[model samples]
Target chain A: MTEKTLIDARGSFCPGPLMELIAQLKSAEVGDEFEVLSSDKGSANDIPEWVEKAGHELVESREDKGVWHITVKKKR
Target chain B: MRILIIGGGMGGTILANNLARRLSSEIKAGKVNLTMLSASEKHFYQPGLLYLAVGQMMPDELYREQVSLLEPGIAFHVDPVTEFHLDENQVKTQSDRTYDYDVLVIATGSRVNMEEIPGLAENAEMFYTEEGALKMLKSLREFEGGRVVVCVGVPHKCPMAPLEITFMMHDFFKERGILDKVELYYTYPIGRIHSLENVAKWATPEFDQLGIKYETFFNMKEVDGDNKILRSEEGAEVNYDLLVTIPAHKGMEVVESQGLGKDGWVPIDRLRLNMEGRDNVFAIGDTTNLPISKAGSTAHFEAEALGENIASMVKIGQPVRDYDGKVFCFIEAGKDRATYASFDYLNPPDPKPPTRAVHWFKVAYNQLYWASARGLL
Candidate 1:
């Protein structure tokens, strides 16, 4: 089942948001997509980079209301 | 214009992000190339390590990859600097790559000199690094209670850490119901408990309340790990079951070997952030002989002026900004409260009381540091 999961890491620092997303991805099915909402500016770049490195598909990444909404799908 | 910054710690990373944002046009136009050379990709939030040692923070919360904090357009290199060719405006890395820059910023910070005092390398557990802190944490958890000595070895990074750890240890033991059994000794090489007058005054009264035996003018000249005793040069000896110390700090070997600082630190114009006799080179953070507290806050404050100074000089051929040497740091006074201290070369704020709100603010600053590193805050 292709489901979307939301992980709000708004107040976390660098690697916190990344670590959260990775943890969620571990329990998430391969077809499931994970969206991370982070206020840290580093997340704008970090999330995408991690997704690519981990062989996950980066669905979309956008900035809204000073928060970064990054979506990634597990590939394996 | 090629701007190369050495050391990817707080100061270098912040400056890189700042330049990339302020000079986006130039960078996009291929007119300015901002590159940062970091020894590794790991960027540790060192302040959080103190909390980690006492089980107040998780291990994962203390660091992130350096590339995670840097923005686009800044070239990040993971190479240790081996030599500085200041005369040629170039630096050589351990990878044997030579980079020549129109302007260079040295932010390599300081290095711990464990060899300074005999037996220090083997005897002491430190909170200065992740591994050291974790070892101390494990030791603290297993041991029931005994004499725990926290020593300020020399002028080291984060001057408040020794005091902060001592305070945290007090709280840790008290919570475990072993406070009465544990004898805490805090020592510094200086004649006083603190360097700043206001900080000393603020912390002096709490010494008795915490049941801490604070000693001054006690320098660690040698350590006897077998007996777990620290010997001072002035014929003073302190016996402890657990020994924690802040080791001696010195500038990077590359900087000293190049004779850039003859004084074992990068010599720079304190206000200008420019290297002495080298207009195209600038030094910031713990790397320079700024005679200021080498805390992340100092680097954060210096980054504002140093970044602008670099941007102006690259665009207009002269720097327009001056650094005021402002430094702000939170001193955690155990029992869940912390105090905020802000000062500069000219002005020092009055000592303020510790509060839970300031402690929360300190945690917020840790979170906010991520954005600040990206120059977003």
Candidate 2:
């Protein structure tokens, strides 16, 4: 079974969501995917930008009902 | 109507965006022209410099192109204004271009005066600018352990920065397993290291817990670079193996040369934010010699009232509200914990206790600030 960690950073500020993602990514095994839910207007742009800069693969990103659902796959 | 904003730093950009948003109709109808004169094409998120010193943020992440953050309707001019002639209601740029405006907002901000303290520019590393922060970062990486003194030479921007550096250095040394080998010191001009009374009370115990020494009322006078000693005007001396000092800050030379300032600092009516003698010419942020922290947060607050007043003046030839001089700034206490303080002209600083969550909020603020600065937030 594939396990995915979920982080609900909705309503948190800009870097709050990004930092949470980084903190969770630290202990995740290689190939582990994490989905971060954020409501900050800047998170959609900030998270993907940081993920790319940190050499991680962004699996998918979608917005549902004013919330951003960003999924990332841990790539060593 | 022509609105010219000088200095595209924090205050200018925020004011421009707010004005653009408030007067979108007039702007679209070609009834008003709004132009911003910035010294460079880039706007530095200065509060992030402290983060850069500790390697928490990259240099490129702390700045954005000036034009990128402005609305398409606002004109962005990358040039430094050389002269402001209030008598003629005009400004002259270094490129020999002149811009006349019905209203002018001076947000040129402040600059460091390294020469104010002898041997400072020659020896110590600083974190006030991009170059200074990078140099300090390189020096910090090479530091093994020793006496590290963080000194504030004058009323510098971000009153909490020296304390942040002190706390962060202690944390940095601890993480490197050299905390025992390093002696940390924080020096400021006042009895309390911080300008805010409540924050000082909250940080005093933290200083003891972090093993950081606090030296008060020690205003820097000179630096003996060879011996690594800083002499204060109060006759106190601090020795350091590595020193990161905040140099004396002053208003821009252009503002002073134009006789718009006293002792290189522009004095404005705090509540009005208008030049002492000129109503159409206003000043905000570090450019004004206001008795408040020169942090961007204070400028952001001042811009709120100034923007409304400017908008009312542009529309009906009169201001609607008086500025409250409110300010709020977050203090990072290292180790993923931060606190914040809020104050106004009438109220003393009231600080919220430090917490890990607030630290995350500060981090989030750094990222959100870019979009917010562009008026997206």
Chain B TM-score, candidates in order: 0.96, 0.97
Interface RMSD (Å), every candidate = 19.2, 17.0
* Candidate 1, B1-377: lDDT as tens digits: 99998988889988999999889999999999999999888887777888888888888887788998988999998998898887787889899999999989889888787786889989888877788889989988987888999876555788788778888899898898899999999886544576555677788788877789988756677899888889875568889888888876777887878788732578778789888788888888888765567789888889889899888977897788688768888989985889977776556556588999888888788788788888888
All candidates: DockQ: 0.01, 0.01
- Would you list the C-alpha lDDT of every candidate in the order shown? 0.80, 0.80
Q: Where is model 2 chain A poorest over a 10-residue stretch in terms of lDDT?
A: A11-20
Expressed as tens digits, the lDDT of each residue in B1-377 for candidate 2 is: 89999988888999999999988899999988999999989988999999888889998998888888898679998889998888999999989999999989999988887886788888888888888888898998889888998877555677778778888877887888889988988886655656455777889999988788888756667899889999975567888899888766778888878888753567778789988888788899989866567889878877878989988887898899888767788889985889887766656566777899999999999999997788666
| Candidate 2 lDDT over residue span A7-51, tens digit each | 776533211466557545644677889998876556687668767
Q: What tier of docking accuracy does candidate 1 attain? A: incorrect
Q: Residue B223: error of model 1 in Å?
A: 1.2
> Could you tell me every candidate's TM-score relative to the true structure?
0.81, 0.81
Worst 10 residues of 1 chain B by lDDT: B188-197
